[model samples]
Target: MGEGIPMTNSTDVRQADAAHGREMDPRLFREVMGGFASGIVVVAGMVADEPVGLTCQSFTSLSMDPPLIAFCPALSSVTWRRIRPTGAFCVNVLAAEQRDVSGLFGQRRDDKFEQVPWRRGVSGAPLLDGAAAHIECEIAEIHPGGDHEIVVGRVVALTGDAERMPLLYHRGRYGVLAP
Candidate 1:
């Protein structure tokens, strides 16, 4: 006779599977990752004397003692793929006033830097003219992640204007920091 309350060995296995797979639903990964507060960064590099860049939220500080930082670029990102081959990059922390700049970089347009203003950093990577901060680094290591590459960089120079508030990403929208 079937249990009145739906109890069974298969139910027990399903419950156990649910317990083990308690991580956020893979289908909602984008939404879940967006729920995490992250600073906006423009990752830039120069190749063949031309500068290229893209807006990314996957940047993070890795180590303070060794002065290391890292950012992940999706395998499908053409701009990042070019930068990877260049072997150097600059992470530009977007300023609250530079939302347009962020939009330009985040786009799939070919001429992303056409209308945007930028200047060369010490690393020769394009630095947005009014970023809140800029980290110039050399590619120290590249490791394969699921669908992205974890690019570790050795800090060469870290500079910023503290007067500016950072641009932020949350819940699938770009935002400004609260006062």
Candidate 2:
């Protein structure tokens, strides 16, 4: 066999001449990012008094003093467009057993809440039942991100069961923490 080419480090790879530089493929980027485990959440709100929601894995706690949280929604999300006008939402931190719930909301369906049980929270957003935690908030600010919107929420109410295990997503699949 012929001699193999030398392996290049990240710095060298990144600094390669434009014509010879390697660009990240979207599919590979997604696959690499999928290695990171993230808690699953359902971001829900009422649009014209109708419940609208979408499954999300980009939720995060931003600050303690101000009680701010954030989640990224794809720019093309119709549910997000509907919820944006409401100016409020509820983040339902899914429990380990709520994989079906996440799948339901993740799909393109109008009657997502037909079989799902939920109740209106302080902000009038639908707080899903059996969630590990619920965070009700009013939209604080929305910043533009690449192909997504970074929505910040100012927390108004919060409740949850600490004993329950959170639903997790990794490598394009649902997972739960091992004891």
Candidate 3:
């Protein structure tokens, strides 16, 4: 357990001025973002004695001094609704061979954890087995995005395995780094 961030009513929507007047097609935006490779993670948390999580690729380290990390989850995420009250979560950095795990959590099924192996972390979050690394964190802040919410977490505990190879996603496929 670590310091928890206070939950807001979510009525205050953060808006910003448009970057440019040029309009871009939604499909082209998705295609451009897909071309950029990113690491994937399964952000899991336990609430009411149940595991809740969803596959995430829009996660990244935000700060080092405060030990913060950020992940973007869709505004209508069912899994987020289930775990929001917990105020804590674990980021399981997927290894190269955990493609099946990714597929299992990518769906909107309630029994997502039925076959997954994991244990609770220090922050009461579920740490997935065989993950390349684990980062336990407390919810710090949340900002409203276009269609997703940017969740910032303050890291409490973390560990990694140097031998494990991370999985990457690019252009709609999973891949491993070349030797």
What is the RMSD of candidate 2? 5.6
Per-model lDDT = 0.87, 0.91, 0.88
Instruction: Check candidate 1 and list the clashing pairs.
Output: none
Q: After superposition, how far is residue 166 of candidate 2 from its true place, in Å?
A: 0.5
* Candidate 3 positional error at 33, Å: 0.8
The model with the greatest TM-score is 2
What is the TM-score (0 to 1) of candidate 3? 0.87
When 1 and 3 are scored with TM-score, the better candidate is 3
Candidate 2 regions with alpha-carbon error over 4 angstroms: 1-22
| Ranking 2 against 3 by lDDT, winner | 2
Q: How many backbone clashes does every candidate have?
A: 0, 0, 0
- What are the per-residue Cα lDDT tens digits for candidate 1 across 1-179? 85554435855565566689754445445654667888899999998999899989999999998999999999999999888888889999999888888888988877877887888988898888889999999999999999999999999998999899999888878888678
The residue pairs in collision within model 3 are none
Residues 66-132 of candidate 2 have per-residue lDDT tens digits of 9999999999999999999889999999999999999999999999999799999988999999999
Give the C-alpha lDDT of model 2. Answer: 0.91
* Local distance difference test, candidate 3: 0.88
Q: Kindly report which residue stretches of model 1 are placed more than 4 angstroms away from their true locations once superposed.
A: 1-24
